[model samples]
Target chain A: MHNQIFEKYTKADKSSLIPLLQEVQAIYGYLPEDALTDVSEYVKLPLSRVYGVATFYNQFRMSPLGENVIRVCRGTACHVKNSSNLLFALEDALNIKAGETTRDKKFTIELVNCIGACSIAPVITVNDDYFGRITTKDIPSIVKKYAGKTKTNGVTVTEEAV
Target chain B: MVELTINKIKVKAEDNMTILDAAKSVGITVPTLCHLKDLVPSGACRICSVEVEGFRNLVPSCAYPVSEGLVVETNSPRVRRARKTIVELLVEDHPQDCLVCVRNKNCELQDLAERYSLREHRFHGESKEHSIDISSASMERDPGKCILCGRCVRVCNEVQKIGAIDFTNRGFKSIVTTPYDKGLNVSDCILCVQCIVVCPTAALRERSSMKEVSSALESRTKFAVAQIAPAVRATLGEEYHLPLGTDVTGKLVTGLKRLGFKKVFDTNFAADLTIWEEANELIHRLVNNEPVPMFTSCCPGWVKFLEHNYPDLIQHLSSCKSPHEMEGAVLKTYYAKKLGISPKDVFVVSIMPCTVKKFEASRPELTEEKLQDVDAVLTTRELVRFFNVAGIDFADLNDSEFDNPLGESTGAAAIFGTSGGVMEAALRTAYFTLTGENLETMELNAVRGTDGVKETIIKIGDKELHVAVVNGIGNVREILDQVREGRSHYQFVEVMACPGGCINGGGQPIHQKTDKVLQRMRALYEIDKKMLKRRSHENESIKTLYKEFFIEPGSHVSHEILHTHYHSRKK
Candidate 1:
C-alpha cells in the first residue's frame, strides 16, 4: 500500500504538492517514512533538511496518524476546570499515554493552551470541531466515532480490539 | 540656514537649531519640560517626542537636529499616542497634588496634563514616596514632587557652575540629591536657589517670605520702605502678563506705592554705590598688592560659590555685600537717620529678581547691631503676587519715579541686572577714579551681552587690566577650575549664578515655556542702552552721597557698613 501511494504521489502534479502531501498524510494518517525523502527530491530540498524541517514543527509526523486527533485545552481557564482529569482518562482508556497515538491507531491525544473559546472551557477539540464541558467518561464514545470508518485507497489499515 | 519640513510645512531655521526649534519657528508646537533656553538640553522628558520618517522610534524633537530633506510629523496619531503614553506613565507615578502644589497653577507638568486631556492614569503603579527635605535655610526640597527631569542638576552643574546636586542611582531608583543623600545645607551647596527657579515641579522652592511681608504690611506702627533691584524691573512685568524683558520700572514703583509702602527706593542707587566701593577696593587691592584678583561681590550666588567650593579663594572676593543687601542696610540706618525715625521702627524690604538674595539678606554676617539688614526679601514673583493681592494693575498704573536720594541711578546701575554688567559698571568708575580721565565710550561693548564667560584685556591708562566675566555658575566652575590650576590670568572677575545674570535669576517672574532666560537678558541690555548715564561714577546722586554721607569709597564708615565677610562651609 505504501509503495502504491508513493508511485501515485510521484506522478501527482507539482501545483497540488502542499494539498496532496496534506491529503496523503490525512489518508495514511501521517506522512510515511519514505514520503519526506521522495517529496524533498521532487521539490529539490536535501532529504535530511526536509526531514529536519518536518520534525521541527509539531504539525508534521513521519509515522501513520491515528484515526482521530483529540486535543485537550490546558489553557489558564480550562486547566482550572479539571481538564487534566479528562486528559488522564483519555490516556488510560486509549491504553497509551498523552502525546502518543493509540496501539490500534484510532486516536492521538494532546494538550493545548488557551484556544480562545475559554468562555466554554474544560474544552477539547476533535480534529476541527470543539467539544466543551467534556468529562473523563466521554473519552470512549469520542474515540469510537472514527473507529469503524472505511479506509480510502492508498491509505493504511490497522486492526483494533474492542 | 537650514530648511526642514515639519508636519508637511516647510520652514527655514538657522543651522545648529534643533528640530523642536525649527518646529517652533514655523509655529509647530511641541511640548517640553526639561528644555530651558539658557541651560543645556538634557532631553530627560520624552513629552516632545516626534515621528521622523526613517527613525525606528520616536525622537525627542527638542534635542534632535533637523537634516535636509527630512520629513517630520509633530502631531500624528503615532506621535500623539506615544506622547500620551509617556505622559501617562509619568503621571502614573507622579504625585497627584496639583491643586495643593506650590507650582500649582504654574507647573509645566500640570499644564501638559491639561493640554493632553489626561483625566485618568491608565497605568497606575507604585510611586516612590520621598519625604520633604527642607534642610537648607534658603530653599526647600520636596523629593516627593521631583519629576527627575534633571533641570536642577543641569542648572546646578552647567548654569550655576556648582555640582552640589546630581542624579544618583539608576532607572526608577534614581533621584536628584546631594552626595550621600546629605542635606543641601550640609553639602558644598552655595544656596544660589537657581535650582528652585529651573525646577519644573515644586520639588525645590524658596523658603516662604510671604508671611513676613504680610505681617510687615499689617504692622502699621513701623515705617516700611521698599527697594527694587534693577533686574526686578526687567522681569517683574512678566508677573503682570507683561512680555519678557519688559522694562516696567515706572510701573513697578507705582505698584510698590500701591502696596502701601512708605517709600519705593531703587537698589540701582546702591548698585552704583556698590561699584564705587567695589572698584575702589579693587584699585586698592591692585595698588597695595593685597589679593591680586578681586572678585565682584554684587552677586550673592558668586559669594556663596566662593565660600562653598573655593574657600581658599575667599580672600580674592571683594568684601562687599550685594547692592540689595547694601541698600537694605543703608535704608535702616542712613535713611532712618534722615527721617529722624528709630532704626528699629524702620522696615527695609527689598524686592529682588534673585532667590539667592533672600538667602543673602538673611545672612548672619549682614546683620548690623543684631538687626537684619533687609527685614524681608521678596522675589519678583512674590512682589507680583503681592501686587495682585493689592489689586494693582501694573500696566495701567501711572508712571512714577523712585523716591529721592536713593532712587536716582546711573546706566551702570541699570546694567547690573545683566551678565558682565557689574564688571562693566565697576570698570567705568574704577578706571576713571584711578586715572581721573573719562572713558571714551560709556557703553563698554566688550563686557556686555550673554556669553557664558567673557574674558577681555582693556588698556586702563598705562596698565593692561585683565578681566573675566562669568554669568552662569556653570561657567564659574570652568573659570574656577582654571584658577585652581594656577592658570587664571584674570585680575578681576564677575560671576552671576544665573545665566544672563540677575535679570534671569531664579526669583524672577516665571517664563511659561514660550519666553526664555536669554531673551530676558537681551531685554535688560536694551534697557541699559536707552539710559542716559551709563557710567556709575558719573551718576550725580552717587557722587553727592559719597561726599556728604560716606565721604569716599572704601572710607572707614563705608567699610563698616557695606563690606562683608564669608565663611567656609562643610560638605
Candidate 2:
C-alpha cells in the first residue's frame, strides 16, 4: 500500500533513511507505523533501530496529525506568563492531550519548547496563523474557529471528548 | 595494539577497545554496569566512571576508547566518590524492599551497595512509585526496581532482535517499555524472556507460578504430579552452588518426591515421543513435498516469534506438541486413565528451564475441554527456591529414579536440553525409521556445537537430507530470509530461542559467561554417552505407549491428543 511512498528509496543504503523518512513525513505530515515498517525493510535495518533513531530526533512524529494542528509555546517567557494553563485549557477545548490528535481528527495539540516569539508570551499558533497572549478563556473560541463553527452565527460547537 | 597505562600498569590493547576492556586485560577490576560483553555498548549507566590524567571530568570507562599512551586510574578517590554517589542515587530512587525482592541478594545494585559498605542510605525518603506489570504470562516488569540501565533494552533489540521493548519517553520518566506502554502480551513479544537474564536489577523477572504450585500440592482432592525438563537437570545444580554442568536429574527427582509430589516424571520421555512424531511428520513432508523445512516446535518462544513476525511461515512448524506439554497431556490422559482417575484429579506441573514454558502452558490450544494440559510451570530458578523452601538439601540429596510408564526416556531425549539436540535426536530416529537400521555411530557430530547456525547434508541410504540447526533467536533471520527468498530448501531445521538452547534458558540460573553453557552442553553429551538406548525409537516404554494408547505414529488418535495448530498473532 505504501510502495509508491518508498519506491524511490527502495534500493538506498543506510544513510538515506533520515531523508527518506523526512520525505515521507512531509507528504503525510507525520510518520505512520506502516511507512516506518516499509522504510525499515527498505533500508535493511531493524525496526527498533529505525524507531530509536526517529525518536532521538525531535523532528519526527510517530502519529498522524489532525486536520487542524495547534502548537502551544512552552518557552520560558510563556511558562512564566501561565502558558501551561493555556495548554491545559486548549487540551480541554479540543478534547485531546498534547501529542495526541482528537478522535474525530479535527484538531491536534502539541507543546513545543519555543517559537522564537517571546514578546507574545502565552502564544498558541493554530496552523500558520499565530494567536498571541492566549488566555484560558480564549481557548474555546480559538478552537471553534478551526472547528468550522461560529457561536455568534448559531453554528453547533464541537465538544467531543476523546 | 594501542599502548595504555591502567592503574600504573602498562597495557597494550586494541585501538577501539574501551577503558573497561583494557583494564580487564591487565587484571584491573573496573566495575561495569549496562556494559554487555557483546553487541553495542550503551554507556547509559555512569557506574563505570574512571579518572584520566588529562580529562577534566571522569569518563565512563565503558564508552571511552583506549587511546595511545592513555593513562587511566580505575579506582581513584574522585572516581570512587562519583561511583558511590551514582549507586546511592540509583538505590534512593529504587524501592527499598530488597529483603523480599525476587533478585534480593543477587541484584547488581545490591551487590554494589554491599561492596561499597553502605551502612545507611545517605540520601533517603524518595518517591518509590512504580506500576508492577504482570500482564505477561511468562514474566513481570517492575518499573520501580529499574535503574534505567538499558541492558534489557539492548538485549531485547540487539541480541534477540525482537525489539518488543524499547526506551520510551524521555529523561526522568524514561522507561524500557513496549510501544505505547502496552503490555508485553499484546506486543510482538515472543515471551523468550532473554531480557530477564540480562537485567542487572529485579526489573524483569519470571511470572512465578510457585505459589500456585504450592497451593496445588497442598490440595487434598488432587494428586499433584511433576515433570522435570531435560535442561532443568543440567543447570538446576548451579542454584545450589554446585558445578554449572552438574546433571542433577536423579537428585531433582528425589527433591520433588520429598516436596510431596505424588508422581515425578521426566519430560525427556515426552521429548522422545515428540521426536517419534516429528520425525515421521518430516518423512511425510519430505515424501509429499509439503513444507520444505519442517521446523521443530519445541521452543515456545521461537514458535510465538514465528507466529507474530513471520506469520506466513507458520506452516513450517511441526504439529507435534512441545516435550513438556506432550508429557502433560499424557499425564492427564493416559496416565490418569491407567490409574483409574479423572483428568481433573491429576494436577500436572512442569519444572522447565524456560520462562516461555509458563506462557506455553497457558496457551488455550494446549488445553483439553477447558482443562489445561500443564497446570503450572516452575522454572529452574523457581525449583531451586522450592527446594530451599521445602528444606531439601539438594546438594546432598540421594539420587532417585523417575516413576514407571511415563518416566522412561533414552539418551537422545536427555540431550534435548542443548542446541542442535532435537535435530540429532530426530535424525537418529528418522535415519533408523527410513533405513530400518541405526547409523554405525549414533552421534551426528556435524550438527552438534555452539555455532549460531549449523548446516549439513546427511545421506540416509539413497536419499540425502538437508538439515540445519539455529541456536540464537536472532540468528534465524538469515535462514528465514533464505527460505523467503527461495535460496535454500532445508528438509528439516531445528531452532532454539536461547543461544545454547534450554541449558542456558532464560529461566535458568543467572550466569554471565558463555563458557558455562558449553559445560552444560558437555554434561548433556555425557548423558548421551552413558545411556544404553541412544535413540528415541529404542525406548521400549515409548513403543509400549504407542502400542497401547495411540496404535500408530501418525494415527488420528495420536494427532488428536499430541498435535496442535498455530495462528498468526496481532503485534
Candidate 3:
C-alpha cells in the first residue's frame, strides 16, 4: 500500500512532502503512524520532522477516520449564532468530543476556524453535505443519518468531495 | 564589515552576522532565551527583541541580520518593557517553585527573571499542567517548566541526530515529546542525555541518584564503596569555581572517603583491565579473521546505539564490559571476597561523567546471580551537590590516596576519558601482546583532537592498523555504512557518543563559559605524561590481579565476570 504512494512521486522528493502528505491523506483519510514511519525512511527525513511538518498544518490528522467527518464551523458568524452550543449538542448526542471519532466509526466531530460560508450562519458539515443554519435540536437526527449506512471505501463518497 | 550602533556603542561586525552575534562581538550582552550556539537560530522566543529607528515593531535580534547603517536601541524603555513583559509571561506560565526545583539557583530562566527585575507575574493564571515523565532510566522530562525554546528538540535532532523528541500537538498545547509520548526507553533514545545538556530550564535533567546514594550511605547492614571515573577528576573542579581542567583527583578521593565510603577506588584500574582484555579480544579476532573491524564497546551510549540502529553489526562490538562496569563486577566479586564479605553486602557506587552510565549500570546482562554490579551511579554534577549537602570542604581537604588492591592504574588508563584515548591505549597493549614489545613512542598524536572524526594508521608490528575515532554518535552512521558496504578497511574504531569524550559527557556541570572539554583532554594527557608507566599492560596491580584471581586475562572465569553480550532492541 505504501509502495503505491511512493510510485506517484518519482519526480517529487523531500521538497514535495506536503503535497505527498495531502495525497496520502486523500487516499487513507488520515495519516497512519506506520505509513508516516515508512515515509520518514523513504524521504530520508527523521520521524520527528515528518511528524512536525504534518502537525504544523491543520489538514493532516493523526487519528483514525470515522465514517462521517463532521466539521462544525467556529467562524465569527457561526460562533455569534451559538455554534458552540450546536457542537456541545453534537458531542452529547454522539458521546464523542470535537477532534474525536465515535467508537462505532460512524461519526467524527471537528471544530474548525472558518468555512468561508457566513451566508448561512452556524454551518455544520458532514462529509460533502452541508447542514447550515443548524440548531441543538438538529444534531441527533444529523448524527442518526450517518448511523447504519454502509459507506463507500469506509466513507460516504461524493464526486466533488475530498 | 558591517558597522552598526548598538545602544549608542559603535560596533563593527560581519555582514551576514545576526544582531545577537554582532552585539556579542563588542561585549554588549543581550539576553537570549532560545539561542543555542551552533544550532539553527529558532527565534521562537522573542525575548531578544531590539528597536530599530525606521521600523514600527521591535525585531527579534537573534534572527535579524544587521544592515550596514541600522540604528538600533537595545535598552530603551520600550525595549525593557517588552523584554520584561516577555519574561513575566514566561514566568507566569512557569511554576514559581524555584526554591524546591532541581535547578534552583542555576536555572537560566531564574537568572533572566532576576536580570529583568521581574517581581511577580502580571498576567499569571492557568499554567499548563503536565505530569512529570520519569520513564527514562538516565533522564527525566518535566514539560511544565519547558518554555518551548526548542533547544533540547534541536540538539536531539541536529547534534546527536537522534530524533527521539520534537514539538508535537499545536499552538498553546504544543510540547516537546516523544512519539505518542512514549517513554524514552521505548523510543530510539540511546539514554545519552545530550538533550539535557542543551536544555536551558529544568524541563530536561538527569534522573538523579542522590536519594539512592543517600539511602545506601545510611544503611547499616551494607558496606558502601565508591569508584571515581577519570573524567570526573578533570571536570569536578568547575563546580567549585576552580578553573576548568583543574586536576582535583586527590580532592575527589578525599571527598568520597570523607562522606562515609568504606573504600575508595579508581575506575582506571578497570580501564587497564579493559585494555588487557580488549586487546586480547582484538588479537583473537585478527588471528581468526572474524568480525574484521572490531568496534570498541567502552561507551554504553554508543553500544546501545549500535544495537538499536544496526543490529546486524552487533557482532563487531568487543564483548568486554565498559571500564566502570568491569570495576563494579570486580568490586562485588574479587574485592568483596578479599574483604571476607558477600557480594550482596558490597554496595558499589560509581561517579561517572556520562549520564548513560546510570542506565548502563542497571543492565541485567552485566549482573551475576541476579545481583546488580553497581548499586548506584552518580554524575559529576551530583557529586558536587553531595559535597555541598554533606558540608564537606572539598577544596581545602588534604590530598588523599586510593584504596589498595584495585587502586593502581597506569597512564593509559587515565587517558580513557578523552575521545581517542581508548584507541591509543588499546593499540599500545595490543602491540605489546602480539609482538611482545611496546612501541618506542607511545603518544598517538594523530588521533587526539575534538574533531567529529579522526582517522589514522599506526604500525604495530608487520601490520599497519587503520583506525578511526568517532567523537559523536552521529559521526558513526557514515563509518558504519562504509563498513557495511564492505568498502572500508579499518581494523579498529572508537566511538564516543558525546561530541568530546567523557570530559564533555552530559553529566557534567552546565553552562561553564569556556571550552573546558579541550582543557580536560589536555589535563588527562598531562597526567599520563607524568606517570612512570604509560601502557596498560605495565599496571602491576592488574598483573597481580590476573595471577591471583582469574589466572589469565581472557580465561573462562574472567569472561563470565568481565564480558557482556549484545541483543537487538525493537527499534
Best by DockQ: 3
Contacts from the true interface found in each model, as a fraction, amount to 0.00, 0.12, 0.47
Estimate, for each residue in B262-304, the C-alpha lDDT of model 1 and write its tens digit. 8999999999889989998998898898875688888887787
Best by lDDT: 3
TM-score comparison, 1 vs 3, better candidate: 3
The 10 consecutive residues of candidate 2 chain B with the worst lDDT sum are B173-182
> What TM-score, over all chains together, does every model reach?
0.73, 0.90, 0.95
lDDT of 1 at B294: 80
C-alpha root-mean-square deviation, candidate 1: 20.3
Give per-residue CA lDDT, model 3, range B120-220, as digits (tens): 55794777878888987899999999999998888888888988889987888888888767778788888888777778889999999999889889999
- Which docking category, incorrect, acceptable, medium or high, applies to candidate 1? incorrect
lDDT of 1 at B549: 79
- Which CAPRI category fits model 3? medium
List the global CA lDDT of all models: 0.78, 0.86, 0.88
lDDT of 1 by residue, A1-162 (tens): 344445656554445356546655777667775565466446543333344344544566666656677788999898999888988888887788767888877777877877787877778877666677767777677666656763323322222221
Rank by DockQ, highest first.
Answer: 3, 2, 1
Interface RMSD of each: 26.6, 2.5, 1.5
Instruction: State the displacement of the C-alpha of residue B520, model 3, in Å, after optimal TM-score superposition.
Output: 2.1
